[model samples]
Target: MAILWKIDPAHSEIQFKVKHLMITTVTGYFRTFNLEVETETEDFHTAKRIEFTADIDSIDTNNDQRDTHLKSADFFDSANHDQLRFVGGKYESHGDEAKLHGDLTIRGITKPITLDVEFMGTVVDPYGQYKAGFTVKGKIKRKEFNLTWDAVTEAGSVVVSDDVRLMAEVQLIKQG
Candidate 1:
């Protein structure tokens, strides 16, 4: 039988950073998301499956106008494709350092991506619940997923950079 683990939403966060006008980077978070993992044992290296999804409508960047635009057709088009998803594949690990390869789907396009993961160790909580933590980081090009909205200033600076950095601080609770 496989062991099941689910993200503790209250203690997890998914964020992305992107450059604006080649100047400053803007950070955004998906306020609502879910992640589940199945393993043969408590060891995450033994994971058999991993799945994650985030609600695009929950995107927050601290600016209402920009947030609204991000949900529009020009960006995530939350009206159509309401979620961002990731299905995990090969998991390579060496001690606390690891690499998770997976297929990431955005705007209906799926692409292979690899994320660097740091296993933050497992512990028994005060409530006696088994918990695990991980820090994950990766990068993706917006245009690759058809998020190709473009704009330029008179001075010739692009509105948004193609590269987007992804980072997640995740905590999972082991289930019986």
Candidate 2:
């Protein structure tokens, strides 16, 4: 039987960064997201399945206008695609670090992506619950996913860079 692990939303976050105007980077986050992992044992290396999803409408950049634009057809197209999903595939580990390969789907497009993960180990919380933590980072090009909306400043600088950086601080609760 496979063991199930569920993300502890209260202690987890998914964020992304993109260079704006080729000068400053703007940070954004998916306020609503969920991840689940299935493993044969307590060892994450034995994980058989991993799935994640983030609600497109819950995106936040701290700027209402930018957030709205991101949800529009130009970016995430949240109106038609309510969520972005990732289904984990190959998992390669080296000591406490690992590479997680998965297919990420956004705006109806799916692409293979690899994320570097640093296992933060597991612990039994005061409430007697078993938990694990990880820090994940990755990069992806927006245009590849059809997020091609672009604008050029008078100086010929792109409004939003094509490259996007992904980061996640995740905590999971092991279920009995």
Candidate 3:
């Protein structure tokens, strides 16, 4: 029988990091997101489906001005595109690690992405719930998603890097 799993938001995080000024890195996270998974066993290696969505307006970088600019038409354009989504297409395992192939949609642009996944094991929580953990990492070029906003410093360094690294720690609870 197939089992359904729902992401436990309180125990999950979706974050990204990008180079700034070609020297430092700026990190940010989406405060609201969800993931759904379907599997035939408690072992996530058998997962059959996975889908994720994040609210673009929930982006938080701890800087109000930067956040505002990111939401503008130059970046994510949250006013017009409210959400980003990912649909998993395949799961390829190699020993203890796996690759999740998926289509990610951002700012109305869709592109294929492959995420490196590490299964962190499963356990029964204190609340008597079966929970599984996973760490996912990936990278993407923001410009490919129509986030073309950019600037250059007086030193000729780009203000924001086109490459963004995605990182997530997801905890899923099996639904009854």
Candidate 4:
């Protein structure tokens, strides 16, 4: 029998970046996120599920004012939408690369998002726990999901890019 796994929150990271002022960039990370990975199947070719949920208020950009702004109504509206989630989908591994199909919800809008997943392989820890690593990267247009708030600069460049870059490192634990 194969062993499935749960996420080790302490070892996982969730982050995102977006163009700021059209010349600079802004990056932020969520200190809190949860994940569950199904790894019991020896046949990795088959559908394996990845479920994730992130706390919106945990966003950290190292700038208090900016962080507060991000949680305001102009952005995530954290008070109204306290979380961002991606729910179950299949995954296929080819060589070191994989593809994940799931629903990404932000600002209360749920949309289908496909992430380019790279399997960093798996190993057993010194403590004898099985672990898997993955690096995920994807891009989404804020406007497409109704996150259309923006400001134009004097040169006509928007303050925030329509496209946002999301990346994360997931650490999975194995079920005995």
Model 2's lDDT to the true fold? 0.98
Alpha-carbon lDDT of model 3: 0.94
Clashing pairs in 4: 4-175
**What is each predicted model's overall lDDT from 0 to 1?**
0.97, 0.98, 0.94, 0.83
Better candidate number, 2 or 3, judged by lDDT: 2
How would you encode candidate 1's per-residue C-alpha lDDT over 1-176 as one tens digit per residue?
Answer: 89999999999999999999999999999999999999999998999999999999999999999999999999999999999999999999999999999999999999999999999999999999999999999999999999999999999999999999999999999998
lDDT of 4 by residue, 6-25 (tens): 78888888899999987888
**Candidate 2 lDDT over residue span 1-176, tens digit each:** 89999999999999999999989999999999999999999999999999999999999999999999999999999989999999999999999999999999999999999999999999999999999999999999999999999999998999999999999999999998
Cα TM-score per model: 0.99, 0.99, 0.97, 0.91
Off by over 4 Å in 4: 1-3, 40-44
lDDT for residue 121 in candidate 1, whole number 0-100: 93
Off by over 4 Å in 2: none
Model 4's TM-score against the true structure: 0.91
Candidate 1 stretches greater than 4 Å from native: none
lDDT, candidate 1, at 20: 96
Q: Give the TM-score comparing model 3 with the true structure, all chains together.
A: 0.97
